[model samples]
Target: MREVVLVVLQLARMTVTDLLGSLNLPEEHIQYWLNRNEALHNFCSQNETCYSKYELNNKQCWGYEASCSKKDSFSARKAKCTKPNSWQKQIFKKQADFAKLAEVLSTITPICVSNYSEGSSLECSSHLRFCRAKNIFFDFHNLNAKNSKRYRNDVIQKGQAGGNCNMLFNEAALRSRADEKSYLQSWAHELEHFSSYPTFEVSKRQCDVIFEKPTVLIKLDAASSMYHHFCDFVNLYASQHVNGSVDMDIDILWWDTVSFLAAASPKPLIIHYARNCERASEPSALATVIANKNCG
Candidate 1:
């Protein structure tokens, strides 16, 4: 039975590889897929029970959800080690392998970028004030003194005071600081160590259910002054689509973000900036355009 399954997987891989080749993907992509597929086939054959537990739909293997978590119980971790070919490994490898390809695929003409009503700087200011209010006694001066030299320098260079927005503060330090002032200062000190900006948050909305083909919806907030940060976030998000599907809808709330830049400069000037940004061989020109015109 296992022999038959192995043979079938071999044929399927060959067929899929040929189909992928027809799509004109890079040779490296095809080779990488072939190698990974072979590993998958071998694992399935060697451990039929575990392979049987995984979900398969439309020729895509969606590995078990329970195996995806790193914080799983000891028993779950033991199972993962015993099995060795868990879905979490597959997800990480797939994401890493296709990240660069996803970026290039995003630039394809099939992508539709549209702007909605302008975002409000007032709302952004409100958010910033709220953040400040919540940590009312957060002394940047005190925190700066306590932080490491590297962290202090980074905070000075980039206006980023907090570490990555998604990460949690140190539990030990957070617990140790008895007073609110000390606690908040410790929090600020940790935040400077990481560079994370929340200029825009990307969410996929109804693309899977509404579109016939695979479509991605990227929502960018216009209220953000972080145009350069938005580009970085977009590039990171784009790298996740390993399948090379290019049909994308980018919905931008344009007021404070895109329109703010547009309002300051003439159409001809913006166009010149865009041309200079495109023609420049290095990132310096792009950086200049982004800083001066805020349109890159």
Candidate 2:
């Protein structure tokens, strides 16, 4: 009965999205919220026994009072369930594919193949000059059109704005401001004395340097250099990790990125992205973004 109801709810949500047509939210964003809805239902159901036990004793139910108030309806449950960070974190983690992404990231050979290996002064200078000229060097604002004209006109126009490290390297955007590229380029060279390790543990740790900074990650474009690098790398790694290639949809990637960011960083960051990012325009999309913004 619960499964049937969940299915019906999912269909209803999809129907609303379809009715919106081009005005609908990004398919990726829509599906992301749908997944969240399912997770919310599952979470509420899983704790049903606990809620009942608490009620029987005439005690205040932990997640029920503020979140699941008026438990007779699903809409009320959803609105309330999204209020707490702890609840959001659990819902975000319920994504099995996200675990796969995380696993691949933890296991794969990282972009940092070596510790900071300084280049010659002339070489570093040239790289810096190229970056500054293209406005893709250091300032995050420069890479974003909202801040720098050179960035919007040159970097974005040249197709360098929303690519992964591999794509950036392919497009010769490697010397730009990407944290991954910066380490792989001159900055690491300055710290060349730091030892390098070829093992997965060191690679994972090096990657963590980027992942640990969700605040920075949330500021850049979702498809920006570092973001795409991490997301695409996971897909590539997962393909090799399993028997056949695992080709996850772009929507799933978006969902994973959003959920991860929501869990680790401030809600305002994600909310700002939804409100400001070029891709997010419709009301429903903004609502979903705001709704899921509180993930712990």
Each model's number of backbone clashes? Answer: 5, 5
Judge candidate 2 against the unseen true structure and give its global Cα lDDT, from 0 to 1.
Answer: 0.22
> All models: lDDT?
0.22, 0.22
* TM-scores for every candidate against the unseen true structure: 0.19, 0.19
Off by over 4 Å in 2: 1-99, 113-137, 140-216, 219-263, 270-296
lDDT of 2 by residue, 42-97 (tens): 33335554234222222122121223223332222344343554665455433422
> In model 1, which regions exceed 4 Å deviation?
1-18, 21-24, 35-209, 219-296
| Residue 166 C-alpha lDDT in model 1 | 33
Which residue pairs show backbone clashes in model 1? 118-255, 119-255, 162-191, 163-191, 222-257
